[model samples]
Target: MLNTFSLVGINMGGLKISLLGSLMCIAVLPACVGLKPSVEEQVNARIEAYWQAMIQKDYEKAHGFLSPGFRLKVDKFVYRNRFAGKTSYKAAAVDGLSCEEERCQAAMILEYTVHGVPPYGFEFNRTEERKELWVNVEGEWWLLPKK
Candidate 1:
């Protein structure tokens, strides 16, 4: 036989667990319910995620972040060829960004390794600043290909 107690027909142990769960929910729900990421933050996150996919050589994942028009024009093969293995992106940080007219320009500092440089033909580390254009596509931000 199990040792059990109840209050108001609720098992004591189950009630305690339920109370803890309810309290945890009350404590956590506010943080998730009302706090929405600003456009800048969302776009910045997208930019960072894109670069992370690039760093991992996951071109397909990276391509999914591009605008529909861009994707329609540039297939996965072309996208892969355009960006694959040109440089190894070690890290990328969106240090500067601005949003206007439903579009965003993200200026990021990229730490990358380049291979086959002139003369030495050896790999080198370069930190470069680049800006990417992102556009709103059906309420989600997407990368726009430069024409």
Candidate 2:
């Protein structure tokens, strides 16, 4: 008993089989070939965006980058006050990033100018290096709380 169809000289499920194979390849090929950027790259991009939000003095936007757990422990008001009018970055960079599964660690360098000083009466620039941890939550990457 033959239960298969043929089309255009192809057999055994014919166009249906061909279409299914094509869809399978489309779904799985990228994962096999590593077409997507490395996890580190993705983590670095998230870290960069987070810093950019801070540099722009958009505390509300920056707070969005924190992990759900961190947000639960620290509310918006506390987060905003932590950086409000006290920090301004001239430049920022992600020096390194490493990740395993949903967890990532990043080293970041920020060049910033502090705006007010009682003695100096003028802004002074400084460079600071810090390490940040990140987590992938619900398909989105977020910064973890600092230790």
Model 2 steric clash pairs: none
* Candidate 1 wrong stretches, greater than 4 Å: 1-33, 117-120
lDDT of 2 by residue, 79-140 (tens): 99876766576555555566789998776666777877677678776777777789999988
User: Would you give me the overall lDDT of model 1?
Assistant: 0.66
- All models: lDDT? 0.66, 0.64
1-147 per-residue lDDT for model 1 (tens digits): 000110111222212222342345346643336776567656755775687687777899999999999999998889898756566666665556778978998776667778755787888877777778999978999999785
* Model 2 lDDT on a 0 to 1 scale: 0.64
Could you tell me the C-alpha RMSD of candidate 1 in Å?
A: 15.9
